[model samples]
Target: MVAEHSPLRVGIAGHIHLAPGSERPIADALRVELDRISDRPVHGVTCLAAGTDQIFARVVLATGGTYEVILPALDYRDTIVEPSRADFDELLARATRVIHTGYRHSDTAAYLAANRELLSRADRLVAVWDGIPGCHAASTDRTVDEARQRGIPTTVLWPAEARRADRRP
Candidate 1:
């Protein structure tokens, strides 16, 4: 068992829209990778966006770790959270802490700011990327690059077949 004093802080970054038939495998892969990277279950820092962020939070909770959310934009729930997956609210509510970044929503700036917060606070980054750069500014590729530059140990969970056939989202 890992020492109680040393908890692993894991921040998640990945595609918001996951390809059909890919979510379970990706989550399993992420959990396995996180386990391999650290001796203990991890505390997840999530923005609770939709696909990837929510999955990481679930895995962290399943493994006996807590999670915290950082909202990048103002009125995030009113704008972005509504369209997210169904479990988003329950997960958000269950988060150990919630921080709303004062950055108002205007373009992708909010997400970018939240992503930065995730990286800065966590000891490790868990990226569920498809090895492709997403269209948005807060893409998984960009997150990976930032983590690398920050010298944060990262565990990227992208199975060979998990790559999306198309990047429509």
Candidate 2:
């Protein structure tokens, strides 16, 4: 149980490629789940990737909550697409704090380490996953598994109409 005086620290693990037009519904689902979690002030933790992480940060802000960001690597910003760079930069600036994983490259190892760091700081996790098992360590499934292993309460949001895009933004 969370201490009465502490704000809930919620983490996110989700897909980078989400279907077009899925944003509104997904945001709604997040809002609902966040409400169910607690009325205590929220402190979100995310990597601020495109799609889900971006949406989660916005929702946290909307609810008058604060959030921190975790960067996967020193050069992680370079991996963001040019079109989404502005959003990423904006969210990064809005974060109450930022933690870097100390990796030199935005590779699989860096991402896994980043997620681990995120999980370490979080009291619970929100997974915008499709319930599909992943083949690799970087997938949403793997992150959820890690959270469960740590005994972090996890809420999975997969709206009925939610779909994933064929490519990354």
Candidate 3:
């Protein structure tokens, strides 16, 4: 049971792409994964970009938890948040806190910095990863590695089926 004072803080790192038909499973996996770690009130933190970040925010709300959105830049309203504008707007409106980092525009550097901020504040890291390392600074792999280096417990939610699909001929 939680102490009424401290809540579990969870940060998320994951791919921006969710396969055409994999939303439900991924969401379930994330829920299960987080459940295994803390039964306390979960305070989720993520940069609300597009895919996993949005899902994380939704899951937090669904679980009766709260969330904080750390925007990489100030132009989020016009840039990345446009495709899922309605959902983004709703999440933003419901966030426990909303923070926009330095600079008047978004960029790779800003995103990496935002990721660092999320990691720095989280008590744990939940990686919705593909187990593949890519070029992105804020890739799930990098975030997982950073969490490990910082001694924060990390939970991975990439189901085996997702990996199998990735290896299809």
Task: Give me the candidate number with maximum TM-score.
Answer: 2
Q: Please give, for residues 48-108, the per-residue lDDT of candidate 2 as tens digits.
A: 9988999999999998899999999999998998667899999899999999999999999
List CA RMSD, all candidates: 2.7, 1.6, 3.2
lDDT of 1: 0.82
TM-score ranking of the models: 2, 3, 1
lDDT of 3 by residue, 1-169 (tens): 3356877899998877666566667778878877887775589998876778888888888888899988888886678645678878888999989877785777778878888899888988898887879677767788899899999889878876553235235
Q: In angstroms, give how far residue 6 of model 2 lies from its true place.
A: 1.5
Q: Write the number of the candidate with greater lDDT, choosing between 2 and 3.
A: 2
Against the true structure, whose lDDT is highest? 2
Off by over 4 Å in 3: 1-4, 163-169
